[model samples]
Target: MANGVLRPGAVFAGYRIERVLGVGGMGTVYLAAHPRLPRQIALKLLHQNLTSDDYVRSRFELEAEHAARLEHPNVVAVEDRGRDGGQLWIAMRYVAGIDAEKLLSEGPLEPARAVYIITETAEALDYAHELGVLHRDVKPANILLERRGSNRRERVLLADFGIAKALEETTQLTSSGMMVASLPYAAPEAFDNLDPDPRMDVYALGCTLFRLLTGRQPYPGSTLPQLWYGHAQAPIPQPSAVRDGLPVGFDDVILRALAKKPNDRFRSCGELADAAVAALTPVSQLVVPPEPEPQAAPAPEEPTTVEVRTRPVATTPPPSPKERDARLAIASVTTRLSAVQTRAERLEPAFASLKSEFSAQCSADLISNERISSAEIVEAETILTSAVEALDRGDAERALELTRAVRAHLSTAERNVDAVTGRLALLRAVRANPKAKVAEVRFKVHDAQMLALNHGTADQWQAEFDAQLERIDRIAAELSGRHPDYWAYITGLDDVKSHISALVQRMKRERRLR
Candidate 1:
């Protein structure tokens, strides 16, 4: 009924379409049963309109073909790609269970569960990277959680390689000048039209992890432009900062993965995966703590005017060797605590320096006039400096701490830059015209008049205003692209459009638009 339902027995490439599972801008996914294998597979068909565009068709096929070549257990395996009845489709192993987004939306996953999913995904990405495939879109929606049985743990399967780009290889699909990915999860480099790489996947993965822990995307807004600005300017908050009970080490690994610069991130997905695994392990288990002796009770206070004379009591026999060994263990624990304190004191300055440099770079970038500030480059340098200091002092804990701090700073700097750039663009548009003021007054009058006519019900009026605002905003965006100078001259035009669009849509759904 939705255009994807092939008749009950419709067969595509020897598989029968059971039903349509989902549909997107480019195609439809169907649950199909294999003719002889007795297996169910997800079959994706390119939309009819999309196939009319040769570029989209080729890209769709390329993605399927390339993804089919990857054989990792964690990566969803593509079984076949072909056309039937003028419908091009791809068949992949059908994974049963909800996507990561749906699962997280229901509730926060246990920390261990989150770590498990992330680690599995990292391994899958690492494998793809080794094969030279970059999953340009690596958001939570693309990660599927497959639960086979009631007692078995869920398996993480990375899906939707539809936008995956083979590194260093040029394809007709991308050459045709079409944006092939979702903007929300796109890496900063992708925005600059740079070649796709594994680090892009790394940034996306970090964003997904942040969203899972926070119950919201790192940046959320009503509009795409707003979301983009948030991504570009908001700092990555530590998981522990937002949710209580999360381990500090868990925060460190997330921050590291989110490092603005690719070089600053873990050298590879493998490294990141390993770090995640390590973070999930209890620190007490990894590092043995010295055993401390039970504290002795304090002596009772003597009353005033007590007799000064003291009676000698019989002395007990000396402790056995076992007792002596026990005492030695207590001493050892004391020595270990002292050593820990001493090391912490010595490493304090190095850590402080790392933090200072990271902060300074962030500040400079936020205030600078560069078209594109290399926050990643700055972050990478900080990470390297911290790594060197850590190695020099042979303190892994200190090094890890420094790495996390730099990562947090980097995430914040990148977001800030985006926000500032978007706002600056808006401001510039506002300053260019006198008529923009007149347009604002006219729009406000129209809004007020409509409100009065609707019996002063602000909701009804607000709905109308939102629709107009969306239209104006779209027009202004287009104008900004063509006439940057004229954007500032048209005040209230965009705002009016956005507000009106929102209101109208709401009213229409409520049957009040008539």
Candidate 2:
């Protein structure tokens, strides 16, 4: 239990507290160790004052729920959440990298690297939007830049999932009922307190991009209120104006993002990212050896009809043996890479289909039926999403490998559900046999086990389990004097005892599930 303070070595919600990471107006985050796992996690808990407010408590819990639902390569992953000893906490995957706000303190990032970060972040935002989770807080502090090993790739992630929207709804924050976004990044519509829009995220992303490239805000007012008028009426600044060597074309991407009207901004974060990348580095500059221009027919060779073979045309001799081999090698490598990319593109739809399958599977009550856990499905979905991101990043080979893994995972989950279906059918048959040793033995145990694993045994389910147990015991007593026969193999007293004991044990264990 935490008493307005969590000391080192204290345990909260099954995590061993280590040290405080940071404190904010909302709450404090601590570096904590998993009780059963061998990894550390970031434990974010609401402060006591905030916890006392119903809206704040709901917002904190909603943040955990919505953020946990999103599992993308470029989004921070929330591991778990629950209330503990009157304290609400969210456990998240801990990253060892610094946030963009701190990184920019050194200086503006490389132009290429900055674009990469923005692209990845935009991708993450787009994914969350598809999941119906909006990340309203898009700022430098919320974007973390991680290093991708020797490749030196910048792995950017968007954090704080839906906290901003949750905050926006709080009466404490918006007394006038007008919406408030982070001043520097807030879209014009955001100031009008309009309904939440995805374009708001785009607007903030544009501001973050501005800082990433120029190391300064597009509208550098001193305070949130001071920046409001500028956001609504100020001229959009050009990235080129802030930094040297930037193309005037770059202004197109930034100004459109900072557009005063939400409708006038990029329709989606992906569009914004694509436009920025294109403006910064055109495609013509990337594809080299430009497609060979079609050659005109050599002026018909002056209409020469005479016998002129010309020594086999003296055709450039195939460039020399060494040159031919080198060209062959290069061509072969290019062909292989292209093939991999094609295959990746083909498998992308398969991943999307898997997502639909997962959604339908969960909604169909697989977790309630005890066939598989929600965590299992979430893990599969996460892998599929990561594969999509890999494909987007042009890592075709890796994406293809992950797609295969996702296929295998979904297959295993389907098989598990099928097996459970068969078991459930057999149990149903046994439970329906009124003349047997038990009228409700197998089926009742299955129901109890499922309930215990899921929402636990409520008074209603507990009563049901008890009534079924009583009915079974009465039937067993009634069959005590019967002669031993082949029926012993069907709903026998021993079988009844076995299932009863197992269900009881599960019921006890599930008391600690949350």
Candidate 3:
């Protein structure tokens, strides 16, 4: 444990260590095997000395808790975690992939491929935000891409949430006199330590997209202050400016994403992805053809007045039953779509309230969730616009279908907003009386653990333990971050954590006996 590196073949905490996967400021990640299972995992061990620091330990644990809560296909899943000797360790899926930072050595990625990677990463960020988590540190090093296979689409995942924070959490885990987010990718607000928000991630991701597209950082500075100044004060750099033949539209997307004010940026990572996709449309397709010059009016021809005889209006035949039914269906769908739009409008107040409160409190995670709702509303509006266009074109069936889809999107958006507000209410209630909330959450964690242990096989119990840990961790973090004042809550979490360690140890012992 001298340098937090495990020698190959060394067995620790039931994992047979193979070799170092990577090394970083926090610790070293090793490719290791499960003690009783024939599978490998990426095990990360915090540097021994840092583990003794309360802040570092809390941040490391928070990373595991945050990443574990994000059940996203584009996000790395933390499978297990515990302390060994004096170092805290976590086990995660061992992705046979290369980090995006390293991949740059082969030169810039193809524009389409880079956008695809960013889209995937955006999905992971959006999912994390929906669950009230923030990947405070998003950079090329943390963006992982699986080794390519001829028959498979490339897989990209966002990893290393060591600096992540839960929604409305007050602890400044990202700040300990060390730059948690790499300087080049760090947002402007980060330098000022302004309350972190989802826009920070947006800014970082924008920088990342620039890197992948141009094979260089958006702002290259020779020193820390220079980089800080660039992000904080310099004009946003355009990807097209750095790389020849790059789409000009990318410039617009990056400029907005890396805007000086968060308000000027995309509301969520998904929106940024959507814009990036739009940028991929061919310039010719996006351009509007110029109007032809009006032909000169024909020289005044004699106005031959035709007789204006008014004949009796011809009676049109009554509509067929099928036509009448289609008209009725369109009316019904239109009414439903109107109702959906009204519902979304009504929910706007609550959503706005929660967003304002969280933003003022520097709760980036909740703000991001609010943005998710906002994005959903935007999407519903877009669909509604299309529905209107269909109606204009006399496509009643298409219009009806689009209306129904709009309703569904609005419903989903409302549900997401409701969820965010519900979580906010619960967190507020818990903060009202931390002592009592701690006891309640603690009892639940303990009860859940015992129930799992008493009723399942080792593997089942392990799975149960992980599920419960994520549930209770969210409660605990929302109630109070790993603040020293919340020692009781931390201790309760430790008890719940013990269940997993016990199961792992028992499994190893039983395997040896067999």
Best by lDDT: 3
> Which is superior by lDDT, 1 or 3?
3
Candidate number with greatest TM-score:
3
TM-score of 3: 0.57
Better of 1 and 3 by TM-score: 3
C-alpha lDDT of residue 103 in model 3 = 95
After superposition, which runs of candidate 2 have C-alpha atoms over 4 Å from their true positions?
A: 1-5, 171-181, 282-514
lDDT of 3 by residue, 47-107 (tens): 6655564434554565576467667789888888777656688888888989999999999
Q: Poorest 10 consecutive residues of model 3 by lDDT?
A: 167-176
Consecutive 10-residue window with the lowest summed lDDT within model 2: 324-333
Please count the clashing residue pairs in each candidate, in the order shown: 32, 1, 0
TM-score against truth, every candidate: 0.55, 0.53, 0.57
Taking all chains together, the TM-score of candidate 2 against the true structure is 0.53
Model 1 lDDT per residue over 209-256, tens place: 777766766656745456456555666557766776655555656666
Sort by TM-score, best first: 3, 1, 2
lDDT on C-alpha atoms for all candidate structures = 0.58, 0.62, 0.66
Residue 143 in model 1: shift from native, Å? 1.6
lDDT of 3: 0.66
